[model samples]
Target: MNPSHSHPLRIGVFDSGFGGLTVLRALLRELPQAEFLYFGDTARLPYGAKSRETIARYAVSAAEFLVRQGAEYLVIACNTASALALDDLRAALDIPVLGVVETGANAAQAHSHSGDVLVIATAATVESHAYATACAERNLRAVEKACPLLVPLVEEGWIDHPVTREVLSIYFTELMHQSKAAALAPDTLLLGCTHYPLLREPIEQAIPAQIRVIDSAEVTAAQVAAAVHAPQAGTPAAPRFFATDSPAKFQRLGSRFLGQPIEHVELIDLEALEAL
Candidate 1:
């Protein structure tokens, strides 16, 4: 059943860091009336290197925190959490949970007539083989590339720099070469990392014209809107932001991802939850 929101619906969005703001940015467009509570587990971030158990524990705590904040639906905006702990999250949370990986694979199936797609994500997300597994479930073949440098570059706010473009070029060149070597004809290039949406322009410039670029944030927002059919507009409510680390730093860098200034960022301690 599709999830429809009532007026003033509370939607919770969680990420290991500020990258998930892109997802929240898209969701705000799709569900303008719904109130948003975004949590950035910045203190325990770089979740890519954590064990599955640890990742699940951190994600579950974040989910529970959102639920406590009256969130009726949860969006796991972090690719690492979504890749490694989606099933655990879904099983543990009562609210419906949506992840970038599944939404991305669904998009690949819809966009690729050749049933082949290429994914560029962080090392941890690619290492999980979650995208590949999700695509195969839809009868689509996926080639996953671990672009570790892209995240830091994005966080550094060097999105349009020549160096960023060159890095994108190098990654895409190798990805294309690898795709051809595997005898796969891919027509879709799916951005598996949330931060990737920020570098979309440069990344697009580096890819072949024939390949369609799928923004996971965009697709996830569309899917949420489709599932939860509510009024197109609701009362204008300022989004509440939470960070486990420095609120000032989060607001400083998060403004870049959200394409606007972020204000009223609240710092909250999540140490107790981490032990859970």
Candidate 2:
């Protein structure tokens, strides 16, 4: 069932770090009337490098914290959590849950006539092969590549720097070669990491013109909007922001991803939440 438009909705967005802000930014556009609670597990970030068991524990703790804050729905905005711990979050939370990986795969199925897609994501996400599994379930062939360097580049605020562009060029060139080697005619290039959306312009320039770049963040927001039937216009209050560590850093870096000035961010202790 879709979220009712008649009453204000409380939506929770969780990410390993600032990258998930891109999804929140899109959600703001799609669901202007809904109040948002965004939690970034900055202290335990890059969930990408952790074990699945560990990722699940951290994700569940974060999700529970948001639910405690009255979240009616949860959006797992981190690709690593979505890849490794989505089922854990769903099992642990009573609220409806959506993950970027599924939305992205669904989009690939809908948009790709050739039924072939390319995914570039962090090492953990690629290791899990979630996108490949999801696409194959939809009868689509997928080639996944680990673009580990991109995340650090994004966090370093070098989005459009020439060095970043050259890195993209190298990554895409290798990815295209892999696609060809797999004998797949891929028409859809999925930005498997939320951080990649920030580099969209350069990514588009780096890849071949014929291949469509899918911003997973955009597709996830559209899917949520469609599911909820969110109202078209309402002056949404600024989202309540929570960070596990370094609220100052989050506030400083988050606006770039959110596309708006973050007036404030609150520091929350996850361990303290778990005690409650």
Against the true structure, candidate 2 reaches a TM-score of 0.96
Q: List the candidate 1 regions with Cα displacement exceeding 4 Å.
A: 1-7, 273-276
Candidate 2 lDDT over residue span 83-136, tens digit each:
999999999989889999999999999999999999999999999999999999
Residue-pair clashes per candidate, as listed?
0, 0
Model 1, range 1-276, lDDT digits (tens) per residue? 223555577789999999999999999888887789999999989899998999999999888888988888889999999999999999988888999999999889988999999999988999999999999999999899999999899878798899998898899999999899989999999999989998888988899889999999999999887776555555767889999998899999999888789978878788866556
Q: What root-mean-square deviation over C-alphas does model 1 reach?
A: 1.8
Alpha-carbon lDDT, every model? 0.89, 0.91
Candidate 2: what lDDT? 0.91
